[model samples]
Target chain A: MSYNWNWDIFLSPTPSGESTYLGWLLDGLQWTLTLSLGAWIMALVLGIGLGVLRTVPNRLLAGSAAAYVEVFRNVPLLVQLFIWYFVLPELLPTTLGDALKQTDPLAQQFFAALLCLGCFTAARVCEQVRAGIASLPRGQRNAGLALGLTLPQTYRYVLLPMALRLILPPLTSEFLNVFKNSAVASTIGLIELSRQSQQLVDYTAQAYEAFIAVTVLYVLINVLVMFGMRLLERRTRVPGYIGSK
Target chain B: MEEFDWTSIPGALPILADGMLITLEITATAILIGILWGTVLALARLSGNRPLAWLAAAYVNLFRAVPLVMVILWFYLIVPTLLQRWFGVSQSSDIRMISALVAFALFESAYYAEIIRAGVQSVPKGQVDAAFALGMPYHLTMRLVVLPQAFRNMVPLLLTQAIILFQDTSLVYVIGLADFFGAAYKVGDRDGRLVELLLFAGAVYFILCFGASLLVWQLQKKYST
Candidate 1:
């Protein structure tokens, strides 16, 4: 009740006098968006491949994909981020490790976070992709093969088109999760939105305002994503199946 | 390029184990509180009272939209001030665990509510009608007839969420709480062995989560049969 509210702090420059505090937050937002979008793209591509592998006739391929999902999904994202940032360089071949370590600190942080988020999310995305494929009737696969298509062609033309549509909704949630989970990158010092807000609170001593703004920004991102996904879902919807309107 | 010094890790087990206990405590409290409140939110959303339903939906949506770390920070920073004003708490460090608990529970309820709602809806229309025809009130029908069946179907999902909550307890590190991961980091930093300690922590997390997932898988398999 006694705390001072400072709405004007956004326009104030940082202690180092480079940019306004609002500028700091916007930069952080940019990092979050890029990190998450980059991760989502990687996750989607890898997830689809691994997902297909899990459902494939080759037991070896399916087994390896399953093992990948288990390893990635079981570890916490924060721990995975740590492993990427801290442990990875040491384990690599010396020249490569030294090259990675010698990169600009910001690039190092960004790449580490990107790799961690991409792989962690790919695991979840793989599960959804698997579920989506499994939900399709057996006839879909059989019919495609019966039409003289090879397994690869059957998957490309017959399976993926329908399975991707079926998974649009769950995939959207995973996409949103990438953004939310990107906040963990701050632990390794990425200066993303959450970290920027924490910095704002630390500098200005205005905890309530800092967090309220960050919370609103996050909600806005969620609303925009859900709205966009709804449009995608409506367009791709299959007849007689339940879907978002 | 230095060889991993395995010496310090054995000495730190007691400390790490202490931290792990705290981690499990937070996870257990959050799971209990999250499920209890999530059930209420689910019921309210389905309760058909417009104002109550809208409020419940808004709570769930607002929490779901934000990152868990933000919620944890908000509670850690803001609640202490409120508590100071109302309860005259001088030192706030002692209650960081409580703050983390409240944040996780509230944040988790949103996800759990959606799950519970779907579970409740999955129960057949005939079941609700039969309960009503037997002269049961709406609340009793839900409590006695609908929820039991819904809960049976929800066990595996609820366990999966619990596993996630267990993993997420690591986020308490943001507040400087010395949970298992935090303990590992600290000891690692102190001993100049960050790599070894982090690998150890990640391994422990993997073992626990992988084991729990297998358990959940078995439960789901049983349910399907």
Candidate 2:
């Protein structure tokens, strides 16, 4: 039961000695970054569209958008990932399904993870965007109408810019959530950092060291993300308005 | 073409029901322990003692940064070895379950502490000052004045955290605990009813999560309004 507590095993040369563990970790970090960036872009685009739709003043469009947000937001990401990876291809047409199934499994899994993360995060983004839009003063829209600007123009030139500035902090947090949630992809065989750490632990029997490295890596990445967002926040701060505590 | 067998429901019902109980137990225990520990951590973080705050912060950061799957795996696979080596006691599956619960509770406490801290911070400074003016001791004032109001205001957020903890209980499956999802996978694997079994499991999850959402909605309406 007594482990020799070999810190040396973690520090030593890799078993194969051709590829270091740091190399594996860096590869995993690349996938993590790739997945998060892809997912964030999709989420932002779809979320903005859905957010605008939710407030379109048309009941059906608004209600449908609301439903989308509710369903995706309420479900757990892990379950959604499972359904996306395992069931969606089977439900497709034969030719397309076969093509999807025959595609590189790793790529397919990564894409599925991206899709699920994007869709799931989109729900939250929709809510944030809606709140941002709603928090706008009523007079802005009225002034836009008074100036003979169209509704879309009001949203584009006036409302969205100001609203986005107001909601930047929350949006940043949502982005962070998206990044963290990418770890869930590791469950489905994606070679992300968490999974890579697990593999290293399995091989080296150095769970403590492996996890410590993983934790430090995560904290570092998250801190860097937060710092960058803080700079963005300051850059976008409204001139006259003092930020509330 | 194999006809979709809808008739598995009657037989699967009892088995799935058992799994539901296990799921509920895990979720309930996690929430209970998580809330208790989380509250303590929150208080510690908010305490004036610098070292205690730092220690609490470190604990929170460590757990929150690591994925829950890793935490559960550590508890199930490594903790047993560590326990035997350190204490000379053999560990059982039951003990493993307890370890999982402890690990999850500790992890979740970090999040809950943040939530609770936010709730506490939202309270007006004048209220605490007013309590102090009345000559109430710090601990008594916190217990009687601050926490009750903070907790009351935090009902919606607390429910949200509970829902998350409930969902995360699925991570126990990595350690071979036969919770709802694990049961469904087992049933599917046994009969090659993968799609059907998963759909059934998804329905159960949706129901539980949706129910939690409805409860939260009601609570928000009742408490906030």
Top DockQ hit = 1
Q: Candidate 2 local accuracy as lDDT?
A: 0.81
Number of backbone collisions per candidate: 0, 0
Collision pairs in model 1: none
**Candidate whose TM-score is highest:** 1
lDDT tens digits by residue: candidate 2, B1-225: 233565666677777778778778877887787778888898999999999999998888777666677777667666666677788875555766677776777778888888888888888889899999999998998899999999988889988888878877777766767777777777777787767777777777777788888889987988775
Q: Show model 1 residue runs off by greater than 4 Å.
A: B86-93
TM-score of each: 0.97, 0.93
* Stretches of candidate 2 exceeding 4 Å from the true structure: A7-18, A239-245, B1-3, B81-93
In candidate 2, which residue pairs clash? Answer: none
Worst 10 residues of 2 chain A by lDDT: A1-10
